[model samples]
Target: MKKTVTILLFLLINSLVFSQSLVDLSKREKERRARLKGKTIIIQKGGDPARKGATLKTDPSGLAEETEGLDDLTSLDRESPPQKRMIPKTENPPEETGADQKDATDLQKLEEQLRKAKEYVELLTLKMNALWQEFYSMDDMKSRDEIQRQISETYLNLQKAQANEQKLQKDVEAR
Candidate 1:
């Protein structure tokens, strides 16, 4: 059985190696040369056909002289009118009215409130983390329960402060 499997593996490997051999190009080259030998080749430098020189004729009245079956050609030197812009014009500049001034003051107050709320949230978060660490090290169940409650309350306070900060930010943006 081992010998049969080895022979089959060797045959598969050999078949794959023989099937992937490089293609022969000599026959194709000979055929291509034979086909090109009877053709008249015109080799251009830029691969474009050579342009025949043609001049535009103008009449005595400074108009383009028409040619047979060529009525679509216009003078290339004519000046086109300037294009008009489609954008709307803002004629009135923004002025600071009383309502705008009130909004600015309200924004300032909201920013101050948000700053304080963020500081409160940070303090509560740090206290909660410290309590958690302390709760892990405590051996008494009562102390651990107390620490857990404190941590929960601190987390709640932090969430409230964060919510207030977000509300203030939204209010400022709305202004």
Candidate 2:
């Protein structure tokens, strides 16, 4: 049984190897021609004729540009009406309106709030990490419970700070 299986496996591998071998160009061309033998192959040449030296244009071959109402092409070059003198701008900038000033102040305040929120979040994260470390190191069950409670409070505060930061960011972006 092993001998028969080995022979079959050898035959399968040999068949796969032979099937994957690249054929010569001449053989490929002969096979292509044989497959196309019974059909009439029409080869259509496209684009502008080479000998005519005409530019290759996408417009229809026979359509000419409209010459009517054009009158004369050089009429534009004769003369034009005199243009108005341009007013040079003064360098002194326009004063900001009260609303604009208020908006600027609001944006500054929101930016400050966002910065504070980020700092608060960072502080809470550091406190929580420290509490967790202390909780893990403490031998007393009561102290560990206390540290865990503090960690939970810090986590809640961090969540609030993150939410406030997001809100402030949105307000700042809106400005």
Candidate 3:
């Protein structure tokens, strides 16, 4: 009987608290609306208000008649059509120096190799981590040995990639 009375009292308190919170929110909203009741919003962009709906009025007879004024920009050709500009064909284009071009290409190759080496090192590092995780999760001796070997191989490859990346980086910097 005590438990029933306690549960009923808890439900009644919770309902009262929730209803009071709703009333408080509504009161705040009413106060906010009252504060903004007499306010007005206005946006002023550019341009003169007197010329907002005005447009340029051109002479209708000036369409076909040529005018002597310097501001006359209307051109009407009631004749044939327009012609395309003709370009003369050349047999040979000028060639660039081999040494300059070769050096740029070499630098680009070194940079590309460095980028690939960095990516490979990152890949190998992930592979090494996965190998270690697999080794830790397993209990079989043969599988552990296999994973150890793979870890060693990945470590070696990672070292090689790092060295290659360092060498390429130096070469790129020298260029």
For each candidate, what is the lDDT? Answer: 0.57, 0.58, 0.59
User: Mind giving the per-residue lDDT tens digits that candidate 2 earns over 1-175?
Assistant: 9999999999999988777664565689678556544432111122322212112122243323332233322112111222233457769956889999788768867877776566556546655676777788999999888777767766777787789889988888887
The alpha-carbon deviation from the true structure for residue 56 of candidate 3, after best TM-score superposition, in angstroms, is: 60
Q: Report lDDT (Cα) of residue 84, candidate 1.
A: 32
Q: Which numbered prediction scores highest in TM-score against the true structure?
A: 2
Cα lDDT tens digits, model 3, 45-104, are 223332222112234322222222323111110111212335576688457599987886
Model 2 has an lDDT value of: 0.58
In order, how many clashes per candidate?
A: 0, 0, 0
Q: Write down the TM-score for model 2.
A: 0.46
Q: Model 3 Cα displacement at 152 (Å)?
A: 1.0
Worst 10 contiguous positions by lDDT, candidate 3: 72-81
Model 3 misplaced regions, further than 4 Å:
1-96
Error of 1 at 16 (Å): 57
Superior candidate under TM-score, 2 versus 3: 2
